[model samples]
Target: MSVVIEQPKSPRSRKAANWEKYGWMYMRASGAILLILIFGHLYVNLFVGQGIKGIDFAFVAGKWANPFWKVWDGLMLWLALIHGTNGMRTIANDYAERPMVRKVLNYTLWIVCAALIILGTLVITTFDPCIDPNASTYLPGVCAVK
Candidate 1:
């Protein structure tokens, strides 16, 4: 594939910041990082020890007990959500013929993305494994009895 770089419309004429260019770059960079994060996540959750059978509430509690896993999962959530939303926005802009429809779709897409990112980050950062006292049967190892 041949790539053509766009020159300034006029010689020495500075152009405003190119958002589409940055968005494309972000998609590429986030995709590479998400590749590693996702594979590592899958390997740890599905390939380590008893594999899928061992994945339970306790397994997740234990994993989230450490700060490292929290950050790793958080990064994955944020990157994946944004990457998917940006792709959708690009599709909307390209395919939606009506300006009003494109505008509404882009706005809705970003709104949903922001809401999900906020909620997911809250879940990851504020997750408490020992929230329920009655469900200590499986979480006993991860949580201490009061």
Candidate 2:
């Protein structure tokens, strides 16, 4: 007796637009962009000035004060979260045996990703270093002067 392996049937309804293809392209594009963004971020934070020792709340505040860094960080947060969520979705589709389980996992992944992206963007965009009254001693001279 021999066991027979059968190929899965294709979907009967074909969509005019291909989402899987778009998702594949997005992964490649986002990965390239993330490589540059992550490296540049590391170089600036870890290699510049006093190196790793220079990283502090004040340092982050100073960076966020600049519109350029704000955009950079925001883009990085959004891209990375979406990229991760998409990757997890693909994994779920491939490995999840139950349709309900796959659907629940994918939904949870996107919900968490969306929530984090929103919170991170808000923090980056609205960060105020001078808001803490007790932080004057730990904060930079600029915060005290302001």
Candidate 3:
């Protein structure tokens, strides 16, 4: 008795899209940025002033008041989301065996990731802590308009 194993074709031979190369580059770029953004976020949130104890609704409102922190948070949000999403895509490609299953899972993954990213970015950028504070339980007393 004998058995045979078929090897996958080279990407060049199959003329597959260059998505892998782009994906590799994205990983490296996102990883370096993630390191900076992650550390900076931690430094401010855990080391500034009263440290973690200072984190409250007021603290967040103050932070968002500054354009700098807004951009910082926005960058962190985009970078982390793209990095995580790409990583998950790699995992899905590796684990999903059936063509149909892989396609379905990847489609779902991208749709959900995109939706969350858009919604989160919108919320962060447009957030107004002082908007009808009395109407919302999430608002702090300090944010109520006098």
lDDT of 1 by residue, 53-109 (tens): 998888989999899999999999999999999999888877887778888999999
* Cα error of candidate 2 at position 96, Å: 0.5
Order the candidate numbers by TM-score, best to worst.
1, 2, 3
> Each prediction's Cα RMSD?
5.0, 5.2, 5.5
Q: What TM-score, computed on C-alpha atoms, does each candidate reach?
A: 0.86, 0.84, 0.79
Worst 10 residues of 2 by lDDT: 1-10
Error of 2 at 34 (Å): 0.7
Clashes of 2: 0
Q: What is the alpha-carbon lDDT for the whole of candidate 3?
A: 0.78
Cα displacement (angstroms), candidate 2, residue 17, comes to: 1.8
Per-residue lDDT tens digits for candidate 2, residues 95-141, read 88777887799899999999999999889878888787766667655
RMSD of 1: 5.0
- Give Cα-based local distance difference scores for all models: 0.85, 0.83, 0.78
Off-target runs (Cα >4 Å) in candidate 3 are 1-17, 133-146
Which 10-residue window in model 1 sums to the lowest lDDT? 1-10
